[model samples]
Target chain A: MGSTATAKIVALPMVDKHADPEPVETKASAAQMSAAEIQVPEPEPIPTVSLTKVFLGLLGYVTRERMITALLACISIGALFLFWYLGTKYRLEFYIRFKNVPTPYEVYQQLTQVGLSNKYLFNIAMSVRRILLGFMIATIIGVPLGLAIGKYERVRDFFMPVVEIMRPIPAIAWVPMSIMLWPNNEASIVFITFIGAFFPILLNTIHGVHSLDGVLVRAARCLGASEIRLFMNVILPGSLPHIFTGLAVGMGVAWVSLIAAEMISGQFGVGYFTWEAYSLVDYPAIVLGMITIGVLGLACSGIIRMVGVLLMPWLAFAPGGRR
Target chain B: MSMTMTEAETHKGFIDVRDMGVTFGANDNKVVAVDNVSLNVQPGEFVSLIGPSGCGKSTLLSIVAGFVKPTRGEALLDGKAITKPGSDRGVVFQQYSLFPWLSVRKNVEFGLKMAGVEQSKRNTTARALLDLAGLLSFENHYPDQLSGGMKQRIGIVRALATSPQVLLMDEPFGALDTQTRVVMQEILTNIWQQFRISVLFITHDIEESIFLSDRIYVMTARPGRIKAVIKVPLPRPRTAEMTDTPEFMNLVQELKGLIREESLAAMAPEIKDRGLSGFGMKVGPKGVGEIF
Candidate 1:
């Protein structure tokens, strides 16, 4: 394309010079001269940037709102640390002393101690594995069942009552039943986590499928798509945004149930670590476990969001999207 | 080209609506949406259906597109009944129904892909059509990235991508602004000139109907049936300047009168029930009725 433009520029004056005779000589030569000048000069290399200017340029990109947000976050975190310090230093009240709340510095020291210990890493890995396994099981079962119920009224009618009845029962409440049903503590804990994750994913998937644009389905039909093709191409992709919402919510719930189940039944997990700390009166270790759970939950939800953005570039390009 | 000649002789591209009627609800609650409507489009002819709102213009278009079945009669394509939607009859809806999930080029290639056209071939064909519609540069963009006009253009090209025998458009440009609609009309005209596919376009706009169609089928207000089949005496390769001519204005005026009369007739029952003194008072001096 670039070569064609150069060829056109070179050819235009030659044609003008040949077609008209009077004052074309200087004009044609001038055009040729400019074209030659353009061809002769190479593009300049990118200039090297000084360190201070580069730093300032990077700093300039951070808007005032972002700066304010960062400042507010820092102030809030600082306030939390100050409150913790004062509360622990003074032994504030009965509940605070009974709970044995640790100072931020004590918790930080405990975190470093735990980080150095192999048991702490093992507990984290075990907890993460349990959550992932339970979440995957829930997704595999929920997505297909949800799609069926959403797409067909008869299927929905058959399953909706059963789902509604079972959904409200808390994962902790299922601990006794899961223990009786399953052969081992591992299976029971996983079952509890799966129960926690399943409802959210299923409900969200149903909502996603229900909210699919009727025009999209009709348009697919008009395009000569068969039933299977319509489901695969239109229905599945169209409901993706809602499905991602479900997955993210489900991941949070799965972790919640996994920890609860671990506290009651587990031998080696983060929840077990926290429960043991409570029994041993290690307040700082308990705080370390709580912080670990919070950080892990955030990371897991962030990963789910990233996956959603990857699957739906259209959503990424939409107004107010992360992209 | 010779195949089209043979098909023309055999009425291949022809769309025949034989006493087609559609009713909704049951017994006492029944509403006659389209009443014994009959119309036809000849091979390679552009026909527009114009009527007031609630007059089942879209219902009629839907019948031809095979989305809705006629309660009584049937719509035929090349003497065969249209029971379900197929690639044989391509439809362009009032809402630009381009798939939001798909890119512009992929949306155009959808029907072709459904027909099991090889990937490379469909891609080439889609690219050519997009290029013709001046949307080639936006091939990678999703439908959400496009303006209303650009999306409608993509809708048109998507419908045409399959090379369907008859193109059924339901007020394809109704949602666009006046300037965009005019440009779209010209683009549609150019496309029609090249393909010469039989079209049954539905629109309430009198001037638009007169501008694009070879013949216009005017329907009654409710329980829509053919009231008039006005033939446009205008020449093809129609430009925007043609709409300013005496002939175009005369046709517009004539259509306005027909529509106004039907619209009034449709509202007569309501007017009588309300005991409004003047029957024709609601109609403005410009011949535009507010019934719609």
Candidate 2:
């Protein structure tokens, strides 16, 4: 057997690299008689590293990562500060026309006042409760439907057309229908919120379930997992990242639609407070409402993110952490 | 010595697959993956199915594992026809089939839990398997935290956790680097010897089959059929040194010849035609005749 010729090139001598200018038979046939004698040169020794070198290398990596984050944060904060100072200093027409452009300090005061007022907290709590209720209901309906649609072609075919037709219509558009369909005004608002959040959650869940590795399912089957066990053990856990994705998206949609729903429903909520302030042209209160919505949206999304981190800590360190 | 031909003969196969054919789609749209393939794996025997990528080796393994049913013919375990997947057979996939969400211990425990092995026994079984795979310390770590070899080891442990009668492996170490793959082969050989589990391993690598299998079944492509089944007369408890022997080399060469022909056959039609799609061979005159 011509082993040398067929063998992959494994090595070269160090001095041979610098000095040699020779041709040799490296063919497998030439080495057949003494296959054991055929040898590849040893690889160069790795450079030794001291403890200081190792420690410094790790330090450099950490510092570089943190520095980039710090730089981006500084730039964004600086930009925001500049915009606030300039908008108030020159009194921009947009800010002036609304007369609701509270200075940074005034906005802070309003934030504190909203935080302190029991009634304010109550309204905020009510809005959050409504959002939660609607979100919870949508999740219950949407996740199972999404999973079914994802798993079964027949189920998908039956439900997809109806879902597609309903998916595009704005959640606000459902307000009147919901009011008519349900007896209570609160139910109508909740329905609108559900409509707002349902599609993204359902769509993402379907995608997640559909995108699961078929081999994993096969693995589960061979392991003697019953149908329900397979879903719980393999399918559900596999699609969880997508479910979290849907929840985050659904939460965002819920916030956007909840404010709109409250505004339209003429309810005792933050949206109503904002509308009332607008009717009276109370500028600070309007500023308060916008900031409240912004902060609340941030807090809700943050909560969703925190939940995601807690559930799938491994995912946070995955190739690229999107959140 | 107790070793005798009659003993070998009396060692009845654990699974019998006779003239099994798996064809996808229907009638005019039909495509055959495995065609009239018959195989028998005896108790504690290590058998490998080797061929080109499209030679239905995987399909055949899947049929044995009960992941897919043969369109025609029967696959039986201990004389009874197999229909659906069961805990009796465990499969390790090529793609390090460890569940990313679960820790190493948990992944192994999955099959045990399915078998309804109580929590106490499950932990013990999981730990033993993990220890056998040399991954006892990584029990608490998720699949992502492990290297390719470690993940594959976990996969093996997971498959064996149910204490299945047969272990079906589909190129389980195909994704690992060359060095890691060699190490894993050794690890697998050790595990197989320890468990004495009947195995139906599949691979495209010629040398891999020679290194690990007791007998190898070479397959033809497309509407795949078994071309040859050659018994490897190498002595058992094979070591790394055994792979360098003249006998092993000769076996590797023989297997390569079979695989090389199928590989060329598998691609012959594709190279012959400029426009080709799945299973649809466009007959054209720019054809290169059989390489063999």
TM-scores of the models, in the order given:
0.85, 0.84
lDDT of 2 by residue, B11-66 (tens): 44497899998999998998889889998898889999888888888888888887
Clashing pairs in 2: A2-A28, A2-A29, A4-A28, A5-A27, A5-A28
Model 2 lDDT, residue B194, Cα:
55
Deviation from native of the Cα of residue B88 in model 1, angstroms: 1.7
Q: How many residue pairs clash in each candidate?
A: 0, 5
lDDT of 1 at B217: 97
lDDT for each candidate structure: 0.82, 0.77
Interface RMSD of each: 14.6, 12.8
Question: Judged by lDDT against the true structure, how good is candidate 2?
Answer: 0.77
Clashing pairs in 1: none
